[model samples]
Target: MRSLEIHGIDDLRVVDRDDPAPGPGEVQIAVEWGGICGSDLAYWRRGVSGTAVMSHPFVLGHEVSGRVSALGAGVSGPGVGSPVTVHPARTTGPLPERLRGRENLHPDLTYLGSAAGDPHTDGAFAQTITVRADQVVPLPAGLDTRRAVLAEPLGVAMHAVTRAGDLTGAHVLVSGCGPVGLLVVLAARDAGAARISAVDLSSPARERALALGADEALESAADMSEEITVAFEASGAPASLDGILRHIARASVVVQVGNLPPTPISVTLGPIVSQELEYRGTYRFASEIEDATRLLARTPRAEQVITHVLDLEDAHAAFTTAATDPASSKVVLRLS
Candidate 1:
């Protein structure tokens, strides 16, 4: 089997590895496509994402889709040859009674391709990999593998919209037109938002956001005159957070979906006090992977978000392109 591993800053390589076999309650997948996420780019460029630095060589991919090649002892349906996408997060053990339903909050959660854990867990960007059967979500009938690769990030967008609550007919603003930000535009529209506005420095991203159903797209949030009712900050930049607070309508809710820098930064609280604004933080999703698959099946335009695809052997070039190319939205690596 072949695996993509990150050795250090700006260092990536394809190396040979032993093929993994599925254990009880697991299944082995023949990986088809793996999408390059912003976090993945961060790790490749700087060997860290936010505060999670890589202490060892790490395999870097999580947004992946493939077909089941083999099933383990206890795993049944989603049989061999079934197409599926994976939910990357896995809990180390059973959650406490109080946190049973919210597995994302478990203290021992480990996510594929993440450097947050020591002796980093390997990811799915390989020829074949094994994962727990329960983490696999069957793709909707006729869903293309190119689009199905988006399920993970789209699920992040879905979870952000779910956090926004009752967007019915509301004017929504999405700050940052990156992949997740643009997907948030689609999710907000599907959630019944009356108007959607997107902000990003990249013209291509803003254009794609409009094409995906945003009513307005701007280079920066500072240009906004109307007060937005809800805002999703997907840029992870301090300026984005400040702009949202300054422009959003009184009593509006803001959801922080982007991974911000770990260092402390100053922010104004006048909006929170005088305007009674509500700010919330959202982590990885719980059950939205299924919703993402269904959403992609119906929204053909969502495919526009994917701008580049490369072979697994070209892993170094893939990460470089994703990190430096503003025109690129989602860069996927073809494994099969």
Candidate 2:
């Protein structure tokens, strides 16, 4: 089998390696589509994202859909050739004190393709990879592989919307037009939001936001609606956060969904205090994959979210294009 690994900062190598076999309660998947995420771009460009660094060779993909190739002992739900999506959460033991019911809160939690483990428990950027059977969620019937690849990112969007509570009848502002941000727009609309506004620096992203059902799309936060009652900041850019804080209505809820680089923002504490605004941070889905899948199944434009597909052998090019080209919405590397 062939495996692609990140040897160091900005170093990607495709090498022949032993095929992975499933352990008990695990299953081996023949990766069909692996979507490149924004975090993956951060890893490739800077060799680090958040607090994790690529200190050793690591596999760098997580948003993936595949068919069951083999099953490890004790796994029975999906048989060979079943379409599935990887949930991407690897836990150590029982959830920690601060992480109870919050599996993702454990500092030791390992996300597939993240620099959180030694040699990084291989990811979906290859032909064959094994993961716990429980981590495999069967794709909904009629869901295309490209759309199925959105399970993970959609999970994040779902988490963001969940953080804001009921969005029905509220004016929502999603402060990013990336895959995750666009998904937020879809999630809000599905939740019956009265209005959806998407903001991003990329024109293509803004256009996609509108096409995905946002009532308004802007290239920047300037002149945005002051009536936005709920905001999801998925851009991670400091300016975006500032804009979100500036435009949200009094008593509005703001969920910081994007991983911003370590930069300070000019947040007005007055409104947060005087208006009793609710501010929260949303992480990757802890145990929400099931619900995310159901929601995606209901979305009318689920398949249109994917913009490009590439062979797994073209991982480098795929990563490069995602980084340099704003037109590629969701770039997936197909292995089979």
Candidate 3:
């Protein structure tokens, strides 16, 4: 099978590797589409993602859609040739009682393509790969790989909204209009946010936020509402915190979705203290991928979030575009 691997910083290779048969309780998939994520771009550009440095080469994808090619022993359902999307997380062990419902918060939890751990879990940007059967989810009747590829990132967006408690009839603010932030607008609307506004430095990104669902998109937080009921900061820019906090209403919630630098940067905490704001940090999703898949199946608007689809051979261009081009929301690689 052909796999796209990061040899080192700024070194991306589309090399051929062995594709082994699935072991027990595993499912082998022939990848159809793989979305380039911010992390993927980070790995290619710097050989690091947050605190995880890519000490060795590994496949670079987690947002993928494909067809099941083979099921291992004792794995029956989601039969051969079934179109599916994968939930990329794998908990290393049983969750403690305190973390029962929140499987994603497990300390030992790992994800595909993440270099956070020693063995560096491999990702799924290849022609063929195998993963645990439990990680696979069959696509709904009307969904196809093109749209299904968004389930992972959409899951991230949906989970952020879930962290905001309830947004029913609330005026929501989204800081950052990148792919995930754009999806957050949809998630907020789905949760009954009466009005949604987004802010981004990029004019194209702001425009995209409005096209998707945000009632308003601003280039800066200067003109934003001071009555924001909830704010989801998705830019991962530490500097963005100050701007977002300035407009967030008293006692409102702010969910931080983007992965900030491992080292802390200075930010004013007076809003949290003076206004009694509930500042929450949301991590990667738990089971929301299921909801995301179902939502994508029902709505045509979600598909518009994908901006570019490039062939696997054009991965260099894909990663570069995704990293540098604000006009490109989500860039996908066609594997087959």
Q: Stretches of candidate 3 above 4 Å error?
A: none
Clashing pairs in 1: none
Name the runs in model 2 displaced over 4 angstroms: 96-99, 263-270
Q: Global lDDT of each model?
A: 0.90, 0.82, 0.90
What TM-scores do the predictions have? Answer: 0.97, 0.94, 0.98
Q: Over the stretch 1-336, how does candidate 2's per-residue lDDT look in tens digits?
A: 766788876678878878889989999998878888887888889888787777877777898888899999898869999988988988776666765677778766778888866656556788889998879999787676667889899888988898899988988889888888888888888888999988888888888998999998887777678778888989887778877676667888989999967656565556678777898999898777777777777775866678888876787898888888879788888777
Model 1 has an lDDT value of 0.90
Tally clashes: model 1. 0
lDDT of 1 by residue, 22-66 (tens): 999999999999999988888888888877899999788999999
* Per-model RMSD to reference: 1.3, 1.8, 1.0
| Rank ordering of all candidates by TM-score, starting from the highest | 3, 1, 2
Weakest 10 consecutive residues, lDDT, candidate 1?
Answer: 219-228
| lDDT assessment of candidate 3 | 0.90
Question: How do the residues 63-107 of candidate 3 rate in per-residue lDDT, one tens digit apiece?
Answer: 999999999999997999999999999988789999877888998
